[model samples]
Each structure stands twice: as structure tokens, then as C-alpha cells.
Target: MSDQHVYLEEVFSSIQGEGIFVGVRQVFVRFYGCNLRCSYCDTSETRAGNPVICRVWRGCEPGRFSETLENPLGVDIVADLIRDLWSPSTRHVSLTGGEPLLQSRFIRRLGERVEMPFYLETNSTLPGAAVDVAGVIDVAACDIKLEESGVEDDHGVLFKRSLETIEIFNDSDCLVFAKIMILPKTTVATIMPAVTSIAEINPEIPLVLQPVTPHRSNPERLIEMMDAAGRYLRDVRVIPQTQRVLGVL
Candidate 1:
């Protein structure tokens, strides 16, 4: 394994809150840094340099108990922690980030050493890095960011790149799915490109419409969004952030 260390925000076991793998137990490895600035992003703290402290679960107890360690933690140390947290029902170690592909090299090294399956949660804007690490991942939980979301980059440029990344996953045997966040003002016009992109690539890939948490979610609007998606895609569903509803981390 490479000796390169990784800057982490946190590493702990939790049930996945959204998308296809909702409620599946996972050990989340949250890295720092992202390329975009979405308007409703809640994980604002994961936006910068290596954290001075990393939070990790200390024991196998059912109740939450965590301990802190210095940042830029070693790969071997993280691998050991993964082993410590392993269990029969544990699905995979999810590599989530402000954008995990930003640190693709570190992820490649860690994935090589860890025995558990690697689940990648990415923004789908880094096609090059997505291709670099896609073969090793067991699942590609990608996002189709909308223009109205207030991203930092040019909307078309980022959207094209995300589509390219999705196209890569579309051809792979590895599971691929899209997570599109629906805002109050979100309409069929805002969702067509994302829907058409997946349809043009491979229509079988699941499309998940996740509503922004703490917003006034109109059921009728969600159905309309799903109807918009069904025009181009086959399997479309509306799933909210269940972890927030269940009051879990």
C-alpha cells in the first residue's frame, strides 16, 4: 500500500440516509474538500483542509461512543479501525466526502488495503477520477447537480462532466444510480437533462429524487418530478433523507 496519508473529517458506522442504499449499515469515511457550493448543503464543515481532529467510534457498543485522533490519519490505522468495526450485517465502508474523487489517489491506496467492499458517494463531476477508481468500487452512488443549486463552476461544464462520469458508470458491471435533490422551485425543466442523460446512457439505472431536508416538501411536486423522469427513464422513485427523519447520525 502507498504510504500516503488522508485528511479526514470523520470515520464511523452509520446507516446510509439516502438514495439506493438507504438504511444499509456502513462505515462512512468522509474526506474534506469539494468543488461546488450548493445552496442547501448541510455538511458545510467538510469544506476545507485536514481536520485537526478525527472522530471515530471507540467500541462495539450499540450506543454511540466516539474518540478523537489527530488528522491526516494513516491508511493502516484506518484499515485497523475498519476491522475493529466489522460485523455480520456491516455492508461496506462508504467513501463519502465533500467530493471523494478529489483525493482519488488516497482512496485507491486505502481500497487496496481494506477487505470490505468500497461504496463511493460522489458528486459525479470528476469523470477522470471516477474512471480511475470506478473498477474498484462496488457501488457508484452519484449525483446530478441542478443549475439552481448554486454550484461554483459553470453549470453546463459541470453538468457535462457529471454526465460523462455517469456514462462511464453506465457501462460498468458495478451498480450505478443517480441522486437528484429537488428544491421548492425545482420543476420538470430543471430535471430533464439529468433524466435524459441517464436515459441516453442506459435507462435501467435507477433515478432517485431526494427532496432537500427541512424544506416544505410538496408531495404533488415530487410526483410531478417523478412523472417528468419517467418520460425518459424506467425506474424512478422519490426517497427523502430517512436518517434525518429517524434522528440518526
Candidate 2:
């Protein structure tokens, strides 16, 4: 493995809150950078500066972050910590971010060192980087960013890149799925382009519509969006942020 180090925000054990893997236990290794700024983002703090220290939830207790480790952590060190936090029911070690693909090299090395499965939670805008780490990924929750959700993709370049990234993962051995964040104002027209593109890639790929948390969710809108998706896709489901409802980290 290479001696590459990664800037991380936190290392914690928590329920998989988003996507099809919701409620599954995971060891979350949150990296510290992102290329996009979505208005409904919950972890925007991760997008700013490199954290000097990473808060680690060391025990089985959820949200009980009792330890801190110096930043720019090595792959071996991160692997060890993940092993320590992993439980019998732990489904995978989630390489989440502000955009984990930003540190693709570091993730490649971590994949080499860590025995557990890697679940990548990414904003699918980095197909090149996705190519670099795709072999190592076991499951991918690729976000399909919608314009109505305040994703700043003016020219739709990022949207195209997102589809490309998803395609890359779909071609790999990794189990891949598309996740779209639905805001209160998100309409069928707002999501059509993304939904149609995903269908083009492979309609069989499961599509998850996640309502943005803490907002007044429109159930009717979600139903309409799902109906629209059903024309091009086979499996479309509405799954909100269950971890937020469970009051876990």
C-alpha cells in the first residue's frame, strides 16, 4: 500500500441512514472535502477546511465520541480503528465525505489494508476518481443531484458527470444504486432529467428518492415523482433519512 494519508472529519459507528442500506450498522469514515455545495447539505462543515483532529467514536455506544486522533491519518491506522469499532452486525465501512472521491488515492490504499467491505457514499460527480477506486468498492450509493435541490450545476456538466460515475460503478462488480435528494419544492420536471439518465444507464438499477430531512416533506410530490420514474425504471422507492428519525449519530 502507498503511504498516502487522508484528511478526515470523523470516525464513528452508526446506522446507515441513507439509501437502500438504511438501518444497517456501519463504521463511517467521513473525509473532509467536497466539490459541490447543495443547499440541503447536512455536513457542510466538512466542505470547508481540513480538520486538525478527527473525532472517533471508539466504543459500541452510538454517538459517544470519546476519543480524538490527529488528522492526515494513514491507511493502516484507519483500518485498525475501523476493526475496533466494527461489530458483528456491521454491514460495511462507509467511506462517506464531503466527497470521499476527493481523496481517491487514500481510499485505494485503505481498501488494500481493510478487510471489511467498503460502501462508498458519493455525490457521483467524479467519474475519473471513481474509476481509480471502483474495484475496491463493494457497494456504492451514488447521489443524483437535482437542480431544484440547490445543487449549483448551471451547465448540467456535473449532472452528466454524475451519470458517468454511476455508469462506472454499474460496470464494476460493486452493487450500485442511485439516490436522489428530494427537497420540498422538488417536482417531477425537476427530477425527470436525472431519472431519465439513470434509466438510460440501466433501468434495473434501484432508484431511491430520499426526502430532505427536517423540512416539510411532501408525500404527494414523492408519490408523483415515483410514478414518473416508474415509466423508465423498474424499482423506485421513497426512503427518508431513517437515522435522523432514530436520533442516532
Candidate 3:
């Protein structure tokens, strides 16, 4: 293993208001940096330097949490933080990011030492990187981006690889959930191919269709995509970002 430490943005405890684990209390380790620039990202602040303080919106008053240490913590130190944040109410520890696959080795090391189940939230653009640390994660929440989001690189190949990565995890003991962000520009005609691909793999796997928030360039597209997705996907459900509704961080 490399002796070098990996960069980490911040670590904090919060409720999991998205995906299958929605409403569950979780300790979130948000890693800094990302490979892709999704147009509708809400956590743009986390894309830079190691996060030292988190501005949390609580009621009318905003609260702040500070981290004395620097970014990119070593495995041992990260382990201790996970333990400190672990509570009877905590269901899982989420390794989120600008993109978690960017620091797969570091996250794998942290998962190896921690006792609680580890969950990962990824954009599903880096399948090979994700597979490298698949053993360390218990669950993966992957997002499939569409043209409306401005991610116009070879999405066909990226989405295919994402499914391959999901299949890899599905063959294992890990729980995998495929998520597609429904944008105003995303229509059934645009996303049907991707949805069909996922259904072909394992229809039993939970597929989450999340509506793009009002902040996006297109809000009406969300409703259209939801209706379109519902026609082909039996397990599809439309959910907005609950954190936004709750007005929390």
C-alpha cells in the first residue's frame, strides 16, 4: 500500500435524505475533487480544498461545524473519526464526494478498519475505479447523467460501464441501487435506452428516479422524464432531494 495520505474534504454526521437509505442517520465523509462537472450540482462548495467547516442550515439560524485537521486524512485518523461519529442511531457511514472513486484506495483503507457498513454515492462514470474498492463498500448509489445535464462526453460508453460496475457489485454481497437524475431535457426517448439497459441487468434492483430541483435550468423536464420513466421501469419512483425540502445541508 502507498504510504501517502489521501485528500479528504470533510467528515460530518447527518441524516441520509436521499436514495434507498433516505431518513437514516449517517456519518458522511465528503471527499474533495471530481472528474465531471454536472451542471445541477448542489454541493459545489465541496468541490474545492479539504472542507474544514460546514455551513449547515438549521431552522432560521445556520450552524457551523469545524474540523481542526487538514484535508486528505490518513486511514487510521479517518477510522477514529468514523468511530467517534458512530452511534446507535447511525445506520451507515457514507463516503460521498466531489467523486468518491477519485480516492478509492484511501476510502478502501478506511473501510477496512471501520466496523460499520460503508455506503458510496458516485456519479457512475468511473467503473474501473469503483470496482477497485467494491469490496470495501456495502452499498453503492450511482447516478446516470443525461445530455440535459451538460455531461455530453461519451455517455453511452460511460453509462454502459456504470452498469458493468453495478453488475460487478450485484454479483457480490453488496447492495447496489441505480439512480438517474430526471432533468427537464431528459425525456423517455432520451433515457429509455439507459433504463432498458438497467432492467435487462436485474429488474429486482431498486431504481430511483430523482426529479431535478427547481434550481436547474429546466424544471418542467423533471415531470416529463418522470412520466416517461414510469412507463418502462416498474421499480421507478420520483423523489425530490429531501434535504432541499427540509432546508438542511
Question: Of the candidates shown, which would achieve the greatest TM-score relative to the real structure?
Answer: 2
**Winner by lDDT between candidate 3 and candidate 2:** 2
- Between candidates 1 and 3, which one is better according to lDDT? 1
Model with the higher lDDT, candidate 1 or 2 = 2
TM agreement with the true structure for every prediction: 0.94, 0.95, 0.86
Q: How well does candidate 1 score on lDDT at residue 70?
A: 87
Against the true structure, whose lDDT is highest?
Answer: 2
User: Taking the tens digit of each residue's C-alpha lDDT, what string does model 1 give over 17-65?
Assistant: 8888898988888888888889988788888655788778654333465
What is the alpha-carbon RMSD of candidate 3 to the true structure? 3.4
TM-score of candidate 1 to 2 decimals = 0.94
Please give the lDDT score for candidate 2: 0.89
What are the lDDT scores of the predictions, listed in order? 0.85, 0.89, 0.74
Candidate 2 lDDT, tens digit per residue, 1-249? Answer: 134888889998888878888889999999998988889888999987888999997654555789899988888889999998998989899999899998998899889989899999999999999999998999999998887767766638888899999999999999999998888778899889988999998999999999887887887788999999999999999999987678787
Off by over 4 Å in 3: 1-4, 48-63, 215-233
lDDT of 3 by residue, 1-249 (tens): 232466665677778878878888888887778877788887786676555533222122125554457544678887878788777898898988889888877777776788899899998888787778888889988887776777647767777777887787777778988888776666678787777777777877777878777745454665666566666566676666887666544
Residue 86 CA error for candidate 3 (Å)?
1.3
